[model samples]
Target: PGPGAYGLPTTIGYEKHDNRKQRMPQYSFGIRTNVSGKDAGPGPGAYQVDKLTRYGKGGGLEYTMAPLTKFKDKGFGPGPGAHDVHLKPMFKGTEAPAYSMAARHNFNFKKCGPGPSAYMYDINNVKQAAPKYSMGIQTKVLGKNNSPGPAAYGAGDLNLRLNRAPEYS
Candidate 1:
């Protein structure tokens, strides 16, 4: 009785009951004639960018200003001008070639294994472990009715912002 249950005697678990009655698929949905009424045109791997031509090797610096042949008659000098003069000692010869940890990536140094030990919380030495002060037993003395007075334990009274009576506008 289980193919499409066409045989009816199903009471073993009554079709595994989730409030059971669902058999409706004897097949009746065929009328879709390949559904395409209109909008799907661009298909040869469609990813269009019409005229965005950025094909490389073409940015700033084409620079033709050699018209300043030695400033073309020097009419612009207000101060330091021989091409701003540094006459050569900007960085000459301290012979710099020494950083070669065997020329770098040779990779062989990791053996330190046993780590985590230095934490010692209190073996008694910060001024002999300090903490002894003692001055706190006053229970409750402001204008002395000695507290526990108002709404003592379930505590709900003083909502004080100057005891709230001020909306007088």
Candidate 2:
């Protein structure tokens, strides 16, 4: 979930049952290295020139964004569309490494069915999602602020004008 939208094709998967747990390794310890040389295409690789490598154990986590009752009251089943939180923390990197995985229940209702469609059918006819938990390693790169320091400064820093971007409203 970084910047720059080149509009790449993405595919999702759904399930028909609830009790969901992501597919991240319950446990894993490994190493990964990405070398950005004089040129490695564009976008993320545009600022290359170093071999960022980091390794460690890490996992994943997914859960309802809201409480069970709140979600149920909103006509949402414990399906993949019930508004969930996804996080993949890696243990190493230059400014931030990355990880990815997913888990969802269908209440017998999962739909990679296009984009965010599961968000539609919330008949309150299904049960709530059971509690789920996960642990993982922390990546150094992801933790870095790219500011050459521990602090993270965004567009708001350096007195950047807010109206400069489309979200200024």
Candidate 3:
């Protein structure tokens, strides 16, 4: 009952049971070495590294960590000195009424930039005698027909048919 009340309480309970069996609580796969001297410069090579080791006790430990979120660019159609060739008739859920037509010659459409191919011309009769070329149409709207003029008269109230028809040999 002298040298630490009994040999330092059995040498501190056998050194805490040998440090709890050498810090038990492990799922280990290891390779660890460290020796630095003689101007250590990769002189004792064994390089091929990828190592992870963990050991736990008593309670807990958990971790988890994720990270690209919208992009659109659908373009191409209008090249070759495009002047006019725009026709849009998209009415799928109703509400498309306002027609007009009378283009027996002069027809125009413009909305340039962005290409793949679209802006065609050449309407039969040898390109309709080539007067800047004509033969392009796009229609929608099923109402309005004020009848009155019809002697080469080209007015508007809405009634232009033909979506795209110009490309003859």
Per-model TM-score versus the true fold: 0.14, 0.10, 0.11
Which has the greatest lDDT? 1
Clashes per candidate, residues 3 or more apart or on different chains: 0, 15, 9
Q: What is the per-residue lDDT of model 2 for residues 1-169, given as tens digits with 9 covering 90 to 100? A: 5776565433323333223434332333665444755455566656534533354322444466876663345344465665535554454433444444865323423343565543667656456766766698756655444536544445455336544545454
lDDT at 42, model 2: 63
Q: For candidate 1, what is the TM-score?
A: 0.14
* lDDT tens readout by residue for model 3, 1-169: 4555642223233344544344445344876445656455665446433332354332345554632333544346555766533555565534445556954433333434545576565668665564565488756655446444466566654436645566699
- Candidate 2: lDDT of 14? 35
* Full-model lDDT for every candidate: 0.54, 0.48, 0.49
Q: Rank the candidates by TM-score, best first.
A: 1, 3, 2
Best by TM-score: 1
Task: Please give the distance, in angstroms, between residue 105's alpha carbon in candidate 3 and its true position after superposition.
Answer: 41
